[model samples]
Each structure stands twice: as C-alpha cells, then as structure tokens.
Target chain A: MTARIYITPKPDILDPQGKAVASALHDLGYQEVSEVRIGRFVTMELKGSGSPENRQRIEEMCRRLLANINVETFKIEISET
Target chain B: MTARIYITPKPDILDPQGKAVASALHDLGYQEVSEVRIGRFVTMELKGSGSPENRQRIEEMCRRLLANINVETFKIEISET
Candidate 1:
C-alpha cells in the first residue's frame, strides 16, 4: 500500500512562497492566475495493506510531525494497487 | 475556478528530504514506512471557468515553471467548485 499526504497552509495564514510564485507567474504572463498556495506532497510506501487502522496511524503521523496543526491542514489518501 | 497541481520527482530520482523525513518518522515509531518521496502541491485560483483550454494553459505552466521537466512529472486538476 501507498499513502499520499498533502499538507497545506490554513486559508488565513500568509504564504510567502506562494506569493513569490504568484508574482513570478504574473511576470511570465499567466495573468489569469489570481492566487496560489503552495503545500507539501508526500508519498510513502507502507508495509501492510490499506485498512482503517492504517488510516488512523497515518492521520496520527500527520498531526504529530507532517503538519503544523496550528497553521496547516492535511489530507491523506491510501490505496493498494 | 481552482486548480490543484501535484509535482513529483521522477521515480528514479534520489529524494534526500524524503529520506530524512522517513528516518524521523521511524524514530517516532512509524517503523512500517519503508520509503518516502516528497514533492510540491500547489493550489491556484483562476479567473476563468474550467475549460479544456484552461487545463492546457495550466499544463504549460507546469512544464515551464512549476515542474522541472528534466526530473519531475506533474498532474493537474481544475474544477469549478
């Protein structure tokens, strides 16, 4: 199984990296872009099959180390293929 | 409309950051994790409605700036909601 996690900044938080990217986009003529928020995309290979318990474990990992619960939000997707 | 872009390193690439993260997770008791690869997740708001043309434009952006064509691959999802 593999788990993919996305950690993004809270909507109210300021993202300097996103701001810089947006500004760069504007300079490059992508004027249709109004805003951009950057986040982390993490993919990990797990030892076992996907299960409710595994999901819970990944969620715990996100809360403890993958995300700054105070200013960031996370979503996890686990799949077996 | 809002678009989400996920840029991931090519499978053959070495991801030192991911290694560090996996090592940390292992130290924190997540021994089930065997491998990890980290990337960038970007969310952007656009001025126009979601359209095929808009998707193509976003893809071009990914090729030119958001992703390094040499070592990364990107997936884009555009939606009206």
Candidate 2:
C-alpha cells in the first residue's frame, strides 16, 4: 500500500514562494496566471494491506510530521501497488 | 480556470528530504513505511477558458520555470472554476 499526501497552505495564509513564482510567470509573459500557491506532495509506501485504522494513523503522522497544522492543510490518498 | 501542477524528482534520483522523512516516520513508529518521495504542488489560476493550446503553454512553463527537465517530472491538471 501507498500513502500519498498533499500539504498546502491555507487559503487565508500568505505564500511568498507562490507569489514569487506568479511574478516570475507574469514577467515571462504568462499574464493570465495568478494566485499561485505552492505546497508539498509526499508519497509513502506501507508494508502491508490496508487496515481501517491506517487512515487515522496516517492522519496522526500528518499532524505530527507531515503538515504544520497552523498554516497548512493536508489530504491523503491510499493505493495498492 | 485553475492549473494544479505536481512536480516530483525522477524515480532514479535520490531524494534526501524524503529519506529523512521516512527515517523520522520510522522513528516515530510508522515502521510499515518504506520507499518515500517528496515533491512540489503548485496551483495557478488562469484568466480564461481551457484551450488546447493552454496545455502546450503550461507544458512550456513547466519545462522552463516550473520544473527541472533533467531531474524532475511534472503532471498538470487544469480545472474550470
């Protein structure tokens, strides 16, 4: 099994890196682009079959290490590979 | 329209950050986790409809600014909002 997590800045939070990219895009003639937000994509491979409790365990991992609960939000996807 | 891009290191590349995270997770009791990869998630807003050409344009952006073609691979999703 695999765990795929996305950690993104909250909508109300300011993202300097995203802003920098947006500005760079604008300077490069991509004027149509705006409001960019930069985030993290994490993939973790698990050793066994999925258990119902794994979801909660993964959430705990997110809270403890994967995401900063104050400013970032996370989503997870589990898959068999 | 919104474009969500996921940028990841190539499979053959070594990801020290991901290895660090994996080690931390193991220390924290997520022993089931093995291979791990860390990536970037970038969201950009576009001004108009999604045209066929926009995909090409976005790919160009990825090649030039969003991702390092030599070591990174990117996936893009364009959505209407």
Q: By DockQ, who's the top model here?
A: 1
Error of 1 at A76 (Å): 0.7
What lDDT score belongs to each candidate, Candidate 1 first? Answer: 0.93, 0.91
TM-score leader = 2
Tell me which residue pairs clash in candidate 1: none
lDDT of 2 by residue, B21-76 (tens): 99999999999889889999998898887788988888898999999989999999
lDDT (tens digit, per residue) of candidate 1 on B1-81: 999999998999998999999999999999999999999999999999888888888998899889998988999988897
True contacts kept of each: 0.92, 0.89
Candidate 2 retains true contacts at a fraction of 0.89
Off by over 4 Å in 2: none
Candidate 2 lDDT score at position B42: 91
Error of 2 at B65 (Å): 0.6
- Error in Å for residue B42 of model 1: 0.4
Docking class of 1: high
